[model samples]
Target: MKAAILDQAGKPLVIGEVDIAAPGPHEVLIRTAACGLCHSDLHFIDGAYPHAMPAIPGHEAAGVVISVGSEVRTVLPGDHVVTCLSAFCGHCEFCVTGRMALCLGGDTRRQKFGGARLTRGADKEVVNQMLNLSAFAEKMLVHEHACVSIDKDMPMDRAALLGCAVTTGAGAIFNACKLVPGETVAIIGCGGVGLAAINAARIAGAGQVIAVDPVPEKRELAKVLGATHVVDAMADDAAKQIIAISSGGVHHAIEAVGRQASADLAVAVLRRGGTATILGMMPLDCKVGLGAMDLLGGKKLQGAIMGMNHFPVDLPRLVDFYLRGLLDLDTLIAERITLDQINEGFDKMRAGTSARSVIIFDT
Candidate 1:
């Protein structure tokens, strides 16, 4: 199978043939159909995040099951599924407590003593899997827990976004924020995730949905999707604009840009007792907090990893929303390219001009 390999940090990914092993117990093999290039992947590729070398770095994906291990029962060979990085161990305390996304998923990967799931060339060099599911490859071998079968009617390209960008964004609005109907929301970023959050805010019946971004086009698109108002993130009074748009301050402020400025703005635009959910993966050393006055006002700040998702339940529901026309995924996709064009797709991502670039695999 051919995969885009991250041979080294701060370098272009090499497209080459790689060998994928069969499913192990509790594992599932999938014929990759589509995978969305997420900014999070760029964190590793640019060395902002550290990982083992020669790894395949994609997590947002959807595909059809090729086969499953003897113990696997969640999906069958013909089932369509979306893969998630938040693989959960059923017996973990986090899972039992309904916090599956925080499970660490240590049990999902094979032990170091075990053989690698992927290898390259005649020399058979081990290729590390970036996340539990390395969907950049032609095929994927992942823990069954890392994937959930979804409606077949959902287009693979759109479904791929549900795996990460949508899941994280929508999840932040639905799960982390627990946004009540008629509440106000301000999404700090208009990328795929932020747009999804904007859409979700509308679906949840938020009284005012504000989208913020430096890009004019993205802000316009956000309004088309669901945002009742859009704020220029680069403006000197962006927070003031958001606060004024919401009539005082937003009940919920979501930070999806993964930048210190955005994080600060999220807190700045929140209502007295509103919560700020930071979904973006920021720099390791970056710190976000509320000022003493803001803290005294009861403003809360928290991080929602992968939107605190329970993929098995959330992905299917998200698919239903799309199928029912309640979710607008078509607008989220900016381009569809073949595997060979992966590099160009990343280039576009770096430019921060597009919504999302999806890789459509020919199976």
Candidate 2:
């Protein structure tokens, strides 16, 4: 099987052969159909996020189940599914509390670490799966918990983004922030994840959906996707613009850029008693600093992992929205590349031009 392996930081991926993995107990082996190139992946490649090198890094994906372990019953071979990072353990305290996204109990549903899920060079080295999916390869040995079956009719390429961008964006509103109708919302960074936040704000009945991005291309695209306003982060006083647009501050400000600056802006533009959801994956050891005095006014800052997604419930709803023509999955895909062209896709993402470049394996 062919895969793109990041063996070192600040390096191009090595496109080469790797041994295909078989399913372990409670796991599933999926034949890769499509995987979206996301900015988060680049963050790891650039060492913004620490990852064991020589790893197959991909998380957002959709594929057909090729094999399943004996204990796997949620899906079977030939079933189409979308993979998510929020693979849950039903017995975890967080899962029992109805916050499955926060499930910390290790996946009883699958094997852990280097269980021969991926290997390279005549099996001399084992490769790690990013977020346990590693859909960058020709196949994946993932916990069955990471995947949820969706309509096979959904273009696999488009369905792949639903695993991360769509779920992160919409679920933040419907799950994490629980945004109310007519609330003013500002989304920082109009990339794949941020754009989803804008579209979700619209679907949630937000009164004002402000799309903030440094790129004009993305700002324009955001309008088409459902943002009511677009603000340039590079512009002077961009935070002030958001505050002005929402008449002092937005009720919900989402930071999807994963930068301290954007995190501060998301906090700064929040109205009193407002919530700011950090939907992006920040670099390890970095913190979003906020003034204690400002926080005293009841403004809140919080982390949202995988949009606090409950895959079984949220994924099907998102798929239905896609089928209903409300969610703009197509609009989010700026380019469709072959699996071999994944490195170039990440380059485009780093350039801040493409929204999302999906690897169309089945195409």
User: How many residue pairs clash in each candidate at the backbone level?
Assistant: 0, 0
lDDT of 1 by residue, 43-130 (tens): 9999999999989999999999999999898999999999999999999899999999999889999766667899998898999998
Candidate 2 on 22-56: residue-level lDDT in tens?
Answer: 67778888888888887788888888788886798
Among residues 3 or more apart in sequence or in different chains, the pairs in candidate 2 whose N, CA or C atoms overlap within 3 Å are none
Which candidate number would show the highest TM-score if scored against the true structure?
1
Q: Which ten residues in a row have the lowest lDDT in candidate 2?
A: 105-114
Which sections of candidate 1 miss by over 4 Å?
none
TM-score attained by model 1 = 0.99
Which candidate leads in lDDT? Answer: 1
